[model samples]
Target: MAGRAKRLRIHGRVQGVFYRAWTVETARGLGLAGWVRNRADGTVELVARGEAEAIERLIALCREGPPAARVERIVVEAAPDEPAPEPFEKRPTA
Candidate 1:
């Protein structure tokens, strides 16, 4: 797709809360292209590429993630260096 990309590092009670799976579903539902994975540092990381508005919507939704998630904050930044992923999937824990 011809859209922008953003990298998000979500913090706080994110791991073990099905955050990655939730993210995959959300991203795909938004018709985004990217991947989501759990990090070793107890965070959820996502690289999403799609319409800027869609990406913004995803970020807003992530602030209030799955029922079990207690998202404290998210670090968002441009990820123009990242190649867009396809089909929005979940990746192995990093």
Candidate 2:
């Protein structure tokens, strides 16, 4: 499978809106591996690794998160150094 990895920072109405859980579910459904956490700065951060197309689909889903989430923006960056080998998880607040 074609693989790709990325670190994403989601902004605006992300925290306290089930964004992390939503992300975990979404990523897992896409068969991606990574983790999602809430940032102290009121953003949601995620690291995802999987098939290039699947990862892109997951990223797109992040752009329009859960029903309660008003995802304003999502900053996606390449993370070629770190890789994950499990299903998505919801990490503790940071």
TM-score versus the correct structure, for each prediction? 0.95, 0.92
The clash count for each model shown is: 0, 0
Give the CA lDDT, 0 to 100, for residue 62 in model 1: 100
Whole-model lDDT values for every prediction:
0.92, 0.87
| Alpha-carbon shift of residue 92 in model 1 (angstroms) | 0.9
Which candidate number has the best TM-score?
1
lDDT of 2 by residue, 4-75 (tens): 889999999998888998888899999999899999999998989888889889988888899999988989
Q: Model 2, which residues run further than 4 Å from truth? A: none
* Model 1 accuracy (lDDT, Cα): 0.92
Residue 64 error for model 2, in Å? 0.9
Q: Which stretch of 10 consecutive residues in model 2 shows the poorest summed lDDT?
A: 79-88
